[model samples]
Target: MRRLGVWIRAKITLSVLFSLMVFFIFLVTVVITGVLFFLAHFFGLINDEIAKGGIVLPIIILISCILIGTTISGFASRRMVKSIREFIEATKQLAAGDFSTRLYLKSPPEYRILSENFNRMAEELGGIEILRTDFVNNFSHEFKTPIVSIKGFAEILKHDDLSREERDEYLDIVIEESARLASLASNVLELSKIETQTILTDKQMVNVGEQIRQCVLLLAAKIEKKHLDLELNLYDYSLSGSKELLNQVWLNLLDNAIKFTPEHGTITIEMKRPAGLLEMVFRNTGSGIDPEAVPRIFDKFYQADTSHSAAGNGLGLTIVQQIVSLHGGTIVCESEPDQSEPDQATAFIITLPSETSK
Candidate 1:
């Protein structure tokens, strides 16, 4: 049905152009014939020829011009109609999930531009399709693995032949798996909310430095357990933003730092006003991130640790980025991965407006 509509529109366009050309030819012929007759009557010229031949030459010239003009117009309209048809077909193919659809027009600069943009759109759509497929498969695997573990552990616990120690171990595994499942569900929900949110709620004046300190204090136990050194160089800085969302950013960044840092490793956090923007950096000493992985680090369900050995469900950074962006902020990761030096580390830098009225 849509294809039919497109065909009808193209036909109408061609018809209109052709009709305009024919009308123009007719108008020109009438004006020229009228002028010739006027001049002949005033100067008494061609009157005798007209009386004998009844204006046969003018009539023949008009017919010839109309025919020639109509043929040229038809030829011109054919190329345009062909380009339009190609676009319509490409649109249909794209709608049917063929992201490889591309256009290559040869004539006309305008058509070339359209073709270039169309191909670019198709390429982008193809990339987005791949990402979407990866997201679904990753989400399913991440979601199902914990449930399987929980089920297996639950089954083992139901055995009356098991010893007390074995039962306790199995119970612990089941509990941990259940917690993992809960965390996965919660992260998925938070990501969905942030993805759709375009505005901030519960907006207030949030102390940026204080939030980092609070996050540090909250994770003090982990820091001590890992024997990691915590260094804070926070100066008083505040921003108008969503307090709840920004807190998530700090918690995730600090937690990730603690998770990846080595024993006695240095985790340095510095806050300063740089280029009129409030800048904060969280650096941790470890085998930093891979260069290739840095670009996709914040993508939803993307995890550098593909082994699933980490403590997160891969939604933390994605959520942090969304929250920061909602507050008109930016987050970037800089890491010197696999360095020969012992002090090599990964760092995340975040910047935001100091005081947004919104």
Candidate 2:
């Protein structure tokens, strides 16, 4: 609450101080001029002709007051607008893609607050610019890698002397790369669409637990192949959101869990309503994410522990976060490199409001 009023208080304080200073300056000038006149009269220094007819002293005193006031006002105005000019130039630099620009205002509490806010904004913009550049560079590399692989393998397959098994393996490689490229393109388009959606549409009262189980069934083949021990600690929790979108969230999370989980590892899906908000946790004994990388795991094209996670295009979590946001929920990755225990390993926790309609 105090923060809410800080800017208002600052503006009022500044205006009142400026008004008081101006009044005090003129009052001082008048007081000094009156004292001079009184001294002259007491000393009999002003002749009767000068006092009654000339009016020279009074005019000169008035002119002196104007000059003093004008000089002080002009100097103060220039000082004040110096900050404004700095602000304008900073803004120009910011618009020119210089997210490093900052402001440092000392006087006028409002501009100080503005300076702080501007620095914070610049910092955030700088981080975003870095992310954007990384995304483009990563996108180009990811896009080109599969194409090069496909072309090279196709050329290998074109050799007539190749054995049947060799030709079939090359063809499989080509098909896999094509599928990967298709998935990447589809995810990019989906993320673009989801990012532009301000409000959730096609909402229905979805059975959250049932939806998760269905997603598990979709990836049952992968789980079986990995020999993963799957656990379900879910309850009947309904949610009001797009069922299809939420399905994507679980499928991607489970796919990642399966992709990284070693043979005979555990995968657990638990949904619980504690404090009235449903907390759906998907945990797997997969590769642990570095603590520093956890915060940026959702960023587009950010893959943590790339050595263990090279196969992914890194858009899954980004899409999951966007869809979760559309549903007015939050999703987080709570995995640390130190937490390598099977049950206490990497986990994705999604929290959402339970449906009142249920």
Candidate 3:
């Protein structure tokens, strides 16, 4: 449970031992010299000249040993103290919201490990800090949109000169804007709960085909409105996960496809067995994700393009990824701009363990 560096501990131990050894050696030498001096005086072998010369030798040896021991102990203690102080300061900076701070102590292996762990901690903190900042900015903008729309429509409704039809239209706009705001808030809350592990799922073996059909039915209106083609190649695949959560996952993915795909564009859902795993591939002929943004596509509040800001608050993919991970699965994206074939198109491939059905 003691997480301090090994080198510092070793250094302290060695310093103490060295000091004790010097003391022991000095003590033994004094005892032997005292016995010899006493015997010499009693035997009349310590005359004035002999006594003077012998006294100076013992004094010189004792002084030299004391000076050497003190100097070595002081140097060793100073080095250990400096390393510990640096480590403490680095941790304090990290606690104070400075995630970039790191301990540069390179004295011993233990210090090295401590520094490495500190760096890892700092990196994690920095990542979370960035995510929090982005979430706040995105949340504000998402809320602002609906509020602006509602305010504009409400002001129009306040006009006594407006016709009945205009007033009804304004009211409808207000309602729609309110619904948008509610939806944004709901999604944000769900994402937070999922990320914080507050939302538990009752996972069970589920038919992927049925789930896809249900999601498709939910988005039937959007698909028809956009005039997009739906192609299904499901193979009665079953996945072990929360049915409700997985249903949401499919809905978000397909919904995103419908939202981005142009009229006459095609959205395909394919399930296949590959390498003892159940794989679901959702490909859409929508605007391809930017290569630069592909790495962070699943990151919360990340959008490929700012123009699509009106479409979503960008937490949909983040939620989808979390749900998949909860099911012990992985999701990957393959996309290229304006590609001809389905494989070349923007595709999301999700792989789940096939054993979930058992």
Candidate 4:
């Protein structure tokens, strides 16, 4: 047998029709019939008048019930109509880039829930708009800086009487600027790819500790340049996840730690499984991040060190946070300022549920 389906509009209409039928056809008919019979008995016309006016009484009652039911249904359905019209208007405004528009529904519980959800969606859209604007502005500025440097140095290298040292220095400056531009482009592309990925497709049993160790070793040159003391206390723990994505997380965190750690500072990488959760911490001793800047550190294009002296596009931590979220995990940062010891540390602590945990 073939099955049929009623859509939302048809269902709503059918519901209103059913309600009207119950009130007007069934309940109204029964009440009016009882009233007419009582009146016939009260006026001492039960036998003769009942037999003569039985059909007439029912016709009059049915007409009256239809009129009353139409009036009440009109009022109730009008509210529904008004709510739907308002919802359509709000959606149009949203489509036109008006994120501030919201629906104030005072009609029914279901409509109220829909309005609340619409408002929440509007809020998220507004936030994304802000991020987009910031990205465009910041990207332009970042790209412009390297171009300016390359142009200025290339002009200087045109001098015929320049010394070898001066020529080499200008060439080095151009090279560094070009590398910076390339890095920025790569980071932007990576972020765009990750944002569109809705699921972690490549799952594997990865050695969490070994992956982190490799990330740290990859940045050994930078660590040596800073003369930083490296401490590693990794526990043997494996987890089922996307190794490629998690590797990016560790590399970004370690790179940030190396970038911010002062000369001759201390850096620590610790991993442990506690209560069926894999917790990894990367801590570096240096000028700690401010408490106010902690909340927005994971925001795209957000840099706590805003001096532009840092070798970053402000997307590393943002990528780290996104990758962690994809794994159904959490990442947090904590810092303590130095009073006298000068051993203050800033830490990025990541917690993930271990699949191997019994």
Write the residue-wise lDDT of candidate 2 on 1-358 in tens digits. Answer: 8966766556665577578778867776677767877788789987677688667867867786787677666766676678889999999999999998999986577778889999999999999998789989989988998999999998898789999999999999899999999999999999999999998869888988888888888889888987999989987688788988999998999898888788999989898786757889998885677788888899888888676345779899999999999988899888855654657779999998775524
lDDT of 1 at 293: 92
Worst 10-residue lDDT window for candidate 4 reads 1-10
- Candidate 4: stretches off by over 4 Å: 1-76, 338-341
Model 1 Cα lDDT, one tens digit per residue, 1-358: 9989656544554357558756766676566656766677689865566656857866755675666666665765676788899999999999999999999974455566788999999999999999899989989988999899988888878889999999988888888888988998999999999889998878889888888898888999999999998889987688888888899999999999999888999899999886658888999998888899999999988888777677788889999999889888899999897777645569999999875321
| lDDT values for all models | 0.84, 0.84, 0.80, 0.83
Candidate with the greatest TM-score versus the true structure: 2
Residue pairs with clashing backbones, model 4? none
Which pairs of residues collide in model 3? none
* Candidate 1 weakest ten by summed lDDT: 6-15
TM-score of each: 0.80, 0.83, 0.79, 0.80
Model 3 stretches astray by more than 4 angstroms: 1-72, 198-201, 341-343, 356-358
Q: What range of 10 consecutive residues in model 2 has the weakest lDDT sum?
A: 5-14
Residue-level lDDT tens digits of model 3 in 62-147: 67556655655576567668888888898888999999998776645567678888999899999999878988887898789889
Off by over 4 Å in 1: 1-72, 356-358
Better of 1 and 2 by TM-score: 2
Q: Give me the overall lDDT of model 1.
A: 0.84
